[model samples]
Target chain A: MPIPLIQLAGVSKQYGDVRAVDDVTLELEPGEFFALLGPSGCGKTSLMRLVAGFETPDAGRVLIDGRDMQGVPPYRRPVNMMFQSYALFPHMSVERNIAFGLVQQGMAKGYIATRVAEMLRLVKLEGYGARRPEQLSGGQKQRVALARALAPRPKLLLLDEPLAALDRKLREETQFELMQVQRDLGIAFMLVTHDQDEAMAMAQRIALMRSGRIEQIGDARAIYERPASLFAAEFVGEINLFEGEVVQSGEGKFAIVQGGGRIALADDTPLPGPVRIAVRPERMVMSHLRAGSYAEFAGVIADMVWLGDLTVWRVRLSDGRLIRISRSNADAANAAFSRGDQVFVGFEAQSARMLLS
Target chain B: MSLVKKTRGVGDGGLAANLGRRLVLIVPYAWLILFFAIPFLIVVKISISVQRDGRPPYEPVFELADGFIGAWESVQKFSMESYAAIYADRIYGDAYISSVWIAALATLCTLLIGYPLALAMARAPRRWRSLLIVLAVAPFWTSFLIRIYAWIVILKDEGLLNHALISTGLISEPIHIYATQGAVLIGIVYSYLPFMILPLYNALEKQDTALVEAALDLGATPFAAFRQITWPLSMRGVIAGCLLVFIPAVGEYVIPDLLGSDEVLMIGRSLWDEFSTARNWPGAAAVATVLLVLLLVPIVAYQRSHLQTHGAAR
Candidate 1:
């Protein structure tokens, strides 16, 4: 395997009473797009800052290209960060801002000029070299900031909530621009974002942070379909959970019974206590006619919302438990169910996963 | 009935707003016309008039006449004798030259001292920044005369500064600082230190700290970051602080009178001698008018540049 471009080993940091970043160990390979995904105050930004050398870890080491970065100041570190605010120098022109790092490194004036010109074109901001930061629009300023950070061409680039300041349309467009830049440069990119959709769209792998610790790290599909804990399941996407007892745990698949519904899991282990069955909302089929092929659940549609792309159905079981099911509005017939219709919801055995705590 | 009332309300509101906007523009301008502009024109008129031994100590350059021809004849009687007299006397030249030099030096000293303090206050933790700022301008809360008097107690021959120097063996004997140019400079810097720091802090505090961090993240050293980013960005503050210190320091009367030696002559002291002691009102007016013309250029330039950049910022 190729050596990782950056490695964080059991890093931890705290501010007064709050543990901003607990023990987190992660690795990024060359040209890898990694994301630290969490909500505000969850320590994802702190972890990125630690790697950028803005904040030192209280314990543990941050390794950049296999070198210890303990005593290295932010200026000396090879890592660069694109600040969330963009932090473009208002007094400087776009060309000067991009050339700042090269000039600091004492690069030749001729070389620096060409490099700045190249960066402007890379971010699709050609012919905008002489404009001051205040003269640019929000999206234009963001592109200038990206060009500035990438001018030095460091081994790894750190981004702290880079897209949070942009409008929705601009953010979507910039996401692809950022990925293209990373691909063209062939450097590892680490981003911190509270937006799950952004993380899913951009990063190849995501580490979900919860109160300074990584709860789970995997691809979006793995994290969404196979959650290891209840927090992971609820955080990534919506799921309908049913608590039940595992009565038969002999085969690889365990059988769980709750109320009048029996669910068979494809993969499970014997649990010390009762287990819960987690089923994704879109996995279950809802219909007025009961299918006799599998163990089916009969429920009444308690509430319904006709969204433009999908229809959300709230199904109440015979035992008074409510389960949310979403069906695509692909056809008019699929969304014909009303709030008072009697419906039978059923899922395949492969879709139900046993959740044991 | 409601629709009629709403339309009338809207019309009245728009009319009231228009009147309010006009009032906002008129008040300050009217104040300037009444106080600053007329008095300045009167001074200019007196500066060109001949001095005489009378109650007003000068001849009126323009006196209202019975008709247009008489008014034209009266206006033609204006003299350049006062300006010629100022040009002939080397004392007036010396006073103007010395004031500019002394004020320039004092302004430089205040800037060198104020920039660091303002930067420190701006970079300090948010909670402590307010306290530091308050302490920096705390001397302004007291009476100006009392503040100057308080400095006398600290810089005297047997004062606390001399006593500490002697006690610490940093000096061999008491120095003659109370009646020297050093004393005058000390007083000017102490008095105007707040003026320098306040504007600098205002400018520096408004700057986003993330700019400095971005510089560092771009691989610029701490000092380089300061030179490339902080220094250029805070230049407006530096210019403002220098102007605040330099303009008033040139014509300072109280500090020079209290702290300066007999040899250190300034335009303010010269104007005072001509007005109060010698009672040459026209000559003093000429001196004041010349000084105003000299200072007006810089003030207008400063305002013009500020307007240009402030428009760009918006």
Candidate 2:
């Protein structure tokens, strides 16, 4: 197998009492689109900084392109970072900003001009070369930042919350554009972001981080369906948790003795003692009539919210727990349920994941 | 709409409010006219008057008791000899040139020294920044004259600096720094360093550090990043600091008088000599007026260009 483009072997960084990055070890193949997904203070940005050589790891090693990166300053590293704040030089024109990296390398002036034009065209900004950073709009500035970072053609590119400043519509448009650029260049990209939707939409694989530790690493579907822990289940998407004790076990089949009712799973291992079952809101089906095949909970709809494409119903179960169930608005029968109405919220056994913590 | 109508109502209270608003505008205008404009006009009148041996030492051209015709006749008696005398004398020319040269050199030295200090303070941890700022301005608490006096004690031939250098074997003899232009330059730079540092600190502190990081990440070395990013960005502060130091240093009196020898001619010393020793009030006024014009031209040009660029950037 070919060597990985970027690798961090048991890297750790500490800031006073807090450990910003705790023993993070990961690798990205060349031309891979990976994202470090977490909330603020989760050390995702710190991990990216470690790879970019901004913050030296307190322990372990950072390797890029099969070479150890110890004692390497950011200037000498074969990597670039697009900062959260665009960090464009306000005094320089757009063309100058894009050509900055090339000029630093002492490239030929003619080649620098050609490469700057190519980058500007790649970012879809052709005639804005002479304008200063202050003259550009937010989206234009973001494009300029991207162009500037990409001009050097590094082995890997690190982006720290590149779309956090844009509005929703702009963010969505830029997300697709960014993915396209990454694909076109075929360069490894490691994106750091707090927004789950942005990570889900742009990244090929997502590493969920919590409190300076990696909670789980998988594609969006695996992370959403098979969360490794309670934090992962709740952090990625909306999850309805059920506290139960597994009484029966064997042959990938188990029965959970919950306070409200007995839940039997056909596709889960029989873990003894108390466990928490996490079910995604969209996975659970709601019906007015009781369904005997699935593990069902009888409850009354306490709240109903009409989203654009789906309606979420909060059902107060007989055990005094509120379980949220979302139904597609495309179905006419699903709209029959309303607040104060009796309903049964059920989910397939395969959809529910048993959480140990 | 009701609030708008209420605000626009032409009632007695509204009239009183209008008068109060007018008073707010008029007070500062009255102060400028009385304190600044009138005094400036008096100086101009004195600068063109004939010097005489009297209590005031200059002929008063305008008399209120004399009517408008008599005032016109007195205007004819006003002489342009003081301005002509300053123009004809090479001493005044040499003083002007020396003052500009000294001030320009001091400003350059102050910029070189202040830039690094300000950059360091700006990059210091957030908790220590305020303390650093306070320390930078702490020298201002002492009297300016007393500080100059303190410099004398340290810079004299047998003083602390020379003794330390001698003891360290860095010098074989005591340097003749005191009572020279070098001492005056040192004094000016020391006194005006805070002026250079404060504005530079403000500018450097306001910069987004990511810009420097971006420069480094783009393959530029740390020094190159500073040259390409930090220096260009801190130019506004550089200009402000230079003007602050250069303007005052050009017309400085105390530092030159206390630290400089008789050979180091400066316009401030010449003006002082004309006023007290030579007893030439008109000549002194002429010197002061010329210096004011010399400083004001650059100040006005800098302000206009600053405003124009700022407006365009906005």
Candidate 3:
């Protein structure tokens, strides 16, 4: 393929004893929307800083458009970042804040002014150029940050929790706005966020980080459907995991797991002494009785939670294993299940993603 | 309880609170009138009075029979003699100009030394910040006069600094640093450094570090980032620190008397000469009034700008 727009090979950064980024290796295509998703202190922000040239890797090379970026300072790098705090210059007007990067680049005054106006228009903050950051609301500040970071037209744009400061309602709206901007501007975005749903909604590809290492790297759907490990399986969404040992295997693909009970799995490793049979809550089907031919486990509905569009049923097995089952609320008018009711939970063989690690 | 009773209780509390508020507001005004406004009025009265060989050193004109008419008579007795002397004499003019220049230089020196120190303390690790603040403020705990005396020992001809330099072969002869304008400047800058640093540290510490990082991310060099982001943001602190150092340094007596040479003819020294050596109370009071008037300009400017910045921050 035409050389990736950004590349990292065995990149690592250490803070005293803690490895903030441990051997992280990834690539992004031109105009790709990527995300680094993890909990706090997972080094996703550290990795973003590495790409922005604010950090120097201890182990590996970072490349932009196939050029090695070793020893490059932040100012020399072709990257921009939207800070989590939306660190707009409080002393400068919104237009001046956006034009700062262009001014630094020694751009013509007329060109800088036009670009600033265009950026303001792009972020839908027209006529807000003269207003200071302190005068703007939180959502307005976020837009100004976005417009300012985009004003420089760098090869890459890094966003550190860009939508986190906004409320849920505004966050959702800005998420789509950010996506539209990314698509229209055609600049690669590497967003760092702790919110899983945000990552799943925005990023085409996401790398889930844990303690400075990426546990899994794939499209959001693929990562969710086939998590590489138990951590990955549980981190992205709710997963009912059954810990077991491999007792049987056939065709070098499927394996049968024996824990307190047996669980058959398809599309799994042939050799697996100990593993966990993972299934997403939404993937499991719940009924009053065990279905024929499908892998089924009988349990009682221990708890129920009505979540407006979906209802989650907490099923406790005879072996004292708790599993969650999610169902759509399309038939909310005809509610059939409640707490302390007998239920049978089942999932297809293909859905039992066997996490080996 | 009945609504009428609740309303009555609130009314009673409101009256008491209004009385308390009025009392609180009157205290400062009363204090200012007694200590500052009244003393300044007395100085102005003395500044225009005639000097006599009496106890108070100036003619005390009072007539109770005339009442308000007596106050008008006292005003008529007032003369522009002392003010005319100040205008005709070049010494007072030179003293004023020199005082301003010296105070300005000391303020500049303090900023130069204090900004980096403040920046470093601000950027220091969290565990070190409290200790750094304590260290910066440690000088204030000792007596200010004792601190100036300590500087004398350091700057004397056979002082520790000269001895060290001579022993290290850096210089053969001792340098005369004490009782010089440079010595006075050094004393002022050293004494007032904490004033500059504390404000700077508070401002820099409270700044959002992400602003600087964002500047760097926008392709500005490190120095450029500091100039564009850090400096402008910390300007309020700079103003506060400069005012703190400059105002007091203008009328400073101890540092100048103890460390400065006769060549250093600051207004404080001039006022001391006019009052004690020359025994000209009217001349001294006139000089003091002029100095107060000059100081008021910056004090007012500082208050106005401070209010404006606080408003903008909100």
Q: Which candidate gets the maximum lDDT versus the true structure?
A: 2
Tell me which of candidates 1 and 3 scores higher on lDDT. Answer: 3
Candidate 2 structure quality by residue, lDDT tens digits, B97-150: 999999999999999999999999999999999999999999999999999999
Candidate 1 residue pairs in backbone clash: none
Candidate 3 RMSD computed on C-alpha atoms after optimal superposition onto the true structure: 2.6
lDDT of 1 at A10: 91
| Model 3, span A1-357: residue lDDT tens | 699999999999999999999999999999999999999999999999999988899999999999999988999889899999999999999999999999999999999989998999999999999998989999999999999999989988999999998999999999999999999999999999999999999999999999999999999999999889888988998998876666554543444444333545544355757767888998887778767555578889999999999998899998998989888899663288899889778777777887777
- Rank ordering of all candidates by DockQ, starting from the highest: 2, 3, 1
Model 2 segments beyond 4 Å from truth? A247-252, A260-271, B1-32, B63-66
**Largest TM-score belongs to which candidate?**
2
Candidate 1: lDDT of A238?
Answer: 84
How much lDDT does candidate 3 score? 0.90
- For model 1, fnat equals 0.91
Candidate 3 residue pairs in clash (backbone atoms < 3 Å): none
* Sort order, TM-score high to low: 2, 1, 3
Please tell me which model should have the higher DockQ, number 2 or number 3. Answer: 2
* Residue A282 shift from truth in candidate 2, angstroms: 2.2
- Evaluated at residue A278, the lDDT of candidate 2 is 85
Q: Per-residue lDDT tens digits of candidate 3, residues B91-132?
A: 999999999999999999999999999999999998999999
lDDT of 2 by residue, A122-168 (tens): 99999999999989999999999999999989988999999999998
